[model samples]
Target: MLALDFINIGNGDCILIREMEGTRQKFALMVDFGHDCLVRDDHPGELDPRSQRIYAGDFLRELGVTHLDVALATHFHRDHIGGLGRVLDAVTIDRFYTTYLPPENAPELDPFHPDNNLPKAARSALLCLQIFTEALQSHPGRIKQFELVPGTETISLQLTPDLKMDILCGEPALYRRQKEIYDAAFNGERNGYELVRWAKSMNVCSLRQRLYYHGKEIVLGGDAYAHVWETVNLTPCDILKVPHHASFDSTS
Candidate 1:
């Protein structure tokens, strides 16, 4: 079996590909689908994150990607999940991974709105949110919505040999109720312009591995703080799927 190809999906994103071993060949695996809004991708403006799905779909149809083995969502943010709906719409999902921050039901929260940050406008946002909500609500007895709890787990595949992976950090939730508590020391204070940076900081770090292959040993460090990286025991790797999209600035 040839090693999977990490297709440069652009803007610090990629799609891991393998020959379709559906039954006679192989299986195809993919990571986060990158962005939603049509921006100028590395290849061309015509190729947005949607292209990732198209690429995957076309590969599957020709290569036989009838079912997806794994789909890991780094966080709840848009860039990571925006292009996921199309892929799901096309193929069957076997295992889904995500950092589950339980839905905070605020009367102000328009659950109909997919994105908690941006103003409601995009159809993909709404549709994706619907898909997630339905999945969480109508889960089978054994299905689980994985959350990033405090610990390290080796994400080993059945077909791999000598690849090791683990969950590194945690993304805690915030509460806004009768009493408004602002813990600037822990969560960090935002000076107005730093809101995006601040939001980017609260994501958990995840690891990835290729296993005895060329780009075999890799680490996908998600939006983890410096302390998180410093305190943890990381061995290092050939490549790393950065946390929070490579805006690598932490107050050390």
Candidate 2:
């Protein structure tokens, strides 16, 4: 048996998957866990320091999950990765999956670039990304532990013979395109103004994946845009977790 639980973590995307081999045991996989609005000035600010630490932590503990077989952060945007630090602190994750093109693959960034003034949302997202990256880097062994969820790859869960996950899209081509454009812009060959917009376009870089059990299919599109979908190899699916929260850009 397989089950999916869509968590209510305010404005963020969080889904829990359970694959059971028999009535006795099951495995867990969590996808995304942060809110873009939560880290902003608009945050309710109701939770004290103690409560803050235990907010998402308690929720996971209540699920009776001692360890996660896999944890996936589709992109680097805060709404997807913000609460990850807390999640990491609360659970033992065997493997963490993601698709953000690292610094080496992309052009160097100037946080205060005159032509690329980042707004409040981008700044907050960057902060959350830094925190999560720093945490992973501090532990030398963990730096190599992260696995990049490749595009068009299918992964099978060991717990259930009939369960498999397919990555329908994760554009290495887009990463390469971004790298080329940003590299040229920084080198004075193109408009630097476009860099800021490119930075935020990482949403299109999301690694959309699908779960298959028997014949049922569920497509999990994480903030991916229409352009990304157009270039991807896809088939009809039973259910789709709408992309970009069903925003116009994703649907169109």
Candidate 3:
């Protein structure tokens, strides 16, 4: 049996995909553990009292999950990856996947750097990246592999004998264009504001994954926008995780 749990992490995404044999789980994959505010007590204002929020790590522990076959962060947004640190703290991961990798030498990647002047959203994304990188480094032996999902082409993986996954991303040219802007800002050739503005509007680089199991297709659209879907060969799906939180700009 294939089980997919969309954990409630208010305003964010935390999905657990499991392949089970009877009562035992045979394989497990997680996608985008939500923001830190959901688990931390210090950020009470960030949590909505009306929404029941639970930490992905704690939830996994309760389910007797000790290891994860894979953990994927679809993008750099805080809502997508902020709680990754806590998840690492609770369970060991085999492979970690992400869309973009921050350059180690980029000064602005450090949120507290004196020269860093990125706007809040961009800064928050950078901080989440920093935290995740540090967490991986701190547990070098636990996380067996870390890699960036290539945006240049569509890649397919067989997660299990019956489960297959296909990853589709926006055109590589779009990602490269954004990278050029980021590189300029990092090297001090362009102002941080330019990078900030670009970050606000660009979700084209986010990953869109299709899961095939038991003759059913499930599409998990990260923060990908309408323009990104234009480049994809979309098909009928049994379930679709709406992009950009189903915002007006998500669909054409």
Candidate 4:
């Protein structure tokens, strides 16, 4: 049986997927871990009292899951990967996947930088990437493998005899284009407003994933925007994790 747990993490996303044989979990995968605040006791968001909120790591421990077969971070948004540091502290991941892997020579855009006047969205993205990078570095030995989901082709993996997963979207070209704009702005060649505009529209580069269990199909749309769907091939699915929290710009 295939079990999917969509954990309640306020405004973020945390999904756990497991394939079970009777009561034993044969395989396990996690998509995102939600924001860091959700794992903290002093979370400021007014959550529904009846709905219990738990950190991704705690939730895994409660379910007796110690090692994840695979973990995918669809994008660098805080709402999707902020709590990953906490999760890494609690569980061992066998393989880690992401849409973009920062180049080793990437510029340092920290607060101390002379031209660190990035807009809110750009700053937030940088922070999220920094946190994720730190988390991975902290547990280098724990995670056995790391890979980047390719933008040019779909990667199909056979999870089990009856289960499979397809990495459907990853646009390194789009990411590079935006990075160039970001770099120009940081170097004073372009205005900060241009970087802000690009940041707001960067959701188009988020990854889109699809899973097949038996004959049923489930689509995990990450934060992809409407225009992204127009370019990719998406089939009918039994369940769809609506993109961008089902915002006005989510659907095609």
Candidate 5:
């Protein structure tokens, strides 16, 4: 049996996929479990912040899922990875997937990194990266395997003779191009004052994936926005998990 649960983790995403074998073996994969109060600030009637995390944790436990075959972090944004640290602490993940990996020379202590000359936004991003790296260091055996995938890459899992899951996406060429331009401008000191604006614009670099199961296809369109989609190749799918929680600016 194959099942997919679109976990309610507030404005973020926490999708759980299950593949059952015969009667004893089972496999599970999780894609982005995050929660942020700001995303729900406009909806005062939504679930309480504390309850949201608790509920998500309880759901996983109820499923008898002690370990995950794969756990993916689409991006480093707080809203997309906020409560994930807690989840990681609670569960055993065999394989991990993410867009960025800690640098070989990652500092042992928190310090200004990835170029102090960069704007505050970029600096903050580097800090987040540092934190994730530290977490992996703290738990050496927790993650048996780790894969740093980019836009065009794909990860395939064979569940049964008939059911399969394919994680697919196009390469992130446009984002890299934009970064080159940003770097040139910043290096030339031509737009030093607009550093934050240019740095913040990199948020659309989120990863997108297409999950194929049986004969149906579902697209997990991370937080990728309109401009990001324009640079990638996306085919039609049976189901589409609306991008950026269906934010107006996320899609055309």
Candidate 6:
């Protein structure tokens, strides 16, 4: 059986997936954590600042996971990847997965639109993440990064013989055209982390995943823009984590 847990991490979502059983095999995959940047909560009660925010060390200890074979950061947004830094601090990761990064100061404005009309809040978040990415690149022991070419790789969990996972996104490209733009901005430093020039712009969130093997599938859709999700080939799973805080018109 698959031991899956999807906690309502405030506006953002956090998913925990585990499989296998006894006999020297066990594993758990924790998805994103809650974000403090939300308007309301379904639960009507007092607010707790300490609640929902999944700091890396605390989250791992809470789940009793000192390390993870796989850590997937679907995209580079605070809500989706906000807790990644902290999580890395607590757990040793075997593999890290993420989509492409835009330029540092060079942003490809929404061409179709006249001014790339973006909300003030989103713009602020993107700026924060840029700094975060810089840090990610500088971290002494950041988890190794990998390109998840669809139909080229699979994510499986073998605790022993109870659960497994399979996932694919960008099989297809979330933003194929933007790749060139993001590439141009890279200066290729020794740190080797992808860098982007910041000109002030953003797009739909980008994140996708499905866990299964012994009868369980958890789908995590990060804030992939329409360009990303619309083209990607995705098979719906038992548990579907919505993208962009269930936003009305981010990525459907």
What TM-score would every model get versus the actual structure?
Answer: 0.55, 0.73, 0.85, 0.85, 0.72, 0.62
- Which residue window of length 10 is worst by lDDT in model 6? 189-198
**lDDT (C-alpha) at residue 65 in model 1:** 59
Which segments of candidate 2 are over 4 A away from where they belong? 21-25, 36-56, 101-125, 135-144, 150-159, 177-195
- lDDT (C-alpha) at residue 108 in model 6: 31
Q: Per-residue alpha-carbon lDDT of model 3 for 1-252, expressed as tens digits?
A: 999999887668889999999989999999898876675533455555676778888888888898999888887666777777778878888887776555665453466565665567656545655665665556557777777776788878898999999888786876676667656545555355765666675577778889999999999999888877876567899999999889888888
Lowest lDDT 10-residue stretch of candidate 4: 103-112
User: Using alpha carbons, what is the TM-score of model 4?
Assistant: 0.85
Model 5, TM vs. native: 0.72
Writing each residue's lDDT as its tens digit, candidate 4 over 154-206 gives 88989788889998765668756656664553344535576566667567777
Ranking by TM-score: 3, 4, 2, 5, 6, 1
**How many Å off is the CA of 138 in candidate 5?**
3.0
Report the lDDT tens digits of candidate 2 across residue range 14-36: 77788866643367788887653
Alpha-carbon RMSD of each model: 8.0, 5.2, 3.2, 3.6, 5.4, 7.7
lDDT for position 122 in model 4? 60
The TM-score, computed over Cα atoms with residue i paired to residue i, of candidate 6 is: 0.62
Can you write out model 5's per-residue Cα lDDT over 124-192, one digit (the tens) per residue? 544444456566666667778888675555667664565566655444673454445444433333333
User: Which residue pairs show backbone clashes in model 4?
Assistant: none
Tens digits of lDDT, candidate 1, 1-252: 434554433443435544433345354456655544435333464543345433333444554456665656654445555555545545665666654433433112232443334433322233344444444444332222343332234445553342333433342332121012112211322223333333433343433333334455656554455555666566656665555455655324
- Model 1's number of clashes is 8
Error of 6 at 116 (Å): 16
lDDT comparing candidate 2 with the true structure:
0.64
